[model samples]
Target: MDLELQTERLTLTPCTDETLLTYSTNGYKLGPHIGMYLEELKKDASALGWGVWLVIDKQTNNIIGDIGFKGKPDNEKSVEVGYGIISTKQNKGYATEALKCIIEWAFNSDSVNKITAECLVDNIPSVKVLQKLNMTKIKNDNHMLYWQLNK
Candidate 1:
């Protein structure tokens, strides 16, 4: 199914081949990781919602960042969520808002029951965003902290 997760100020557009082509044809400079996402999509059409989703600002109609799952949920029905916003757009609650929308979208799927994430230990902003989502700190290594939320 074609999906566009929406929030108050953002639209999370899944990075399907068609969507990526449309964005590129429209002169949007995609991130390098988008190529990898495209390759995965080429291998499996089911990867549509499991890869990068462009975070678009509803007002300015510009891409503010990207956020989405790394892959489909595993055997345990758990998936990892990741996101990043442009420095200029950071700290405006866009990450939290966009993530909340996607989280709700994911929970609506029977394939997903748990969502997880990881951030560098020193990345206070990301930590705050995950905390704002009410995700619990599950574990941490020397450099990264892991978090989780159950549906």
Candidate 2:
């Protein structure tokens, strides 16, 4: 949404091309993960008022990471929630905190029915983050683990 959402320490807003470019640079240091599709994130913001946003610390306002839903998934009416916390900020519970906000928003939106996500099976931290959100594991393929939050 054009609005801002807050967690105890983070804020979420719609992702834009400006933010996407910023995300690419910030995300690289966080993980080797391929990164978000700029065009797709724009599509989400335009069509749904929801897309990945720069995660800013409430106290520091530092762009520590990003978290939000993308518009592509095999499932209809479903969006995939994705996140990346800077490696420097990793293990501080930021990923889990960011994820909790995104997941709750998805479940509450009429535009989105189910929220799904995937992680490299070897990404132990990500797996735990999803579990903490109560997202159930639904499949594993090609070394990727898939989970869904259906409300």
Best model number under TM-score? 1
lDDT score of residue 138 within candidate 2:
98
Q: What is the lDDT of candidate 1?
A: 0.86
TM-score of 1: 0.91
Q: Which stretches of candidate 1 lie over 4 Å from their true place?
A: 21-29
Per residue, candidate 2 scores C-alpha lDDT tens digits across 1-151 of: 4357789988766555555454334333433222444555444445434555667777766678877766543346688888888888899999898888877776666666788899999999999999999999999999999998877
Q: What's the TM-score of each model vs. the native?
A: 0.91, 0.78
Residue pairs whose backbone atoms clash in candidate 2 = 1-49
Cα error of candidate 2 at position 69, Å? 1.4
lDDT of 1 by residue, 111-137 (tens): 999999999999999999999999999
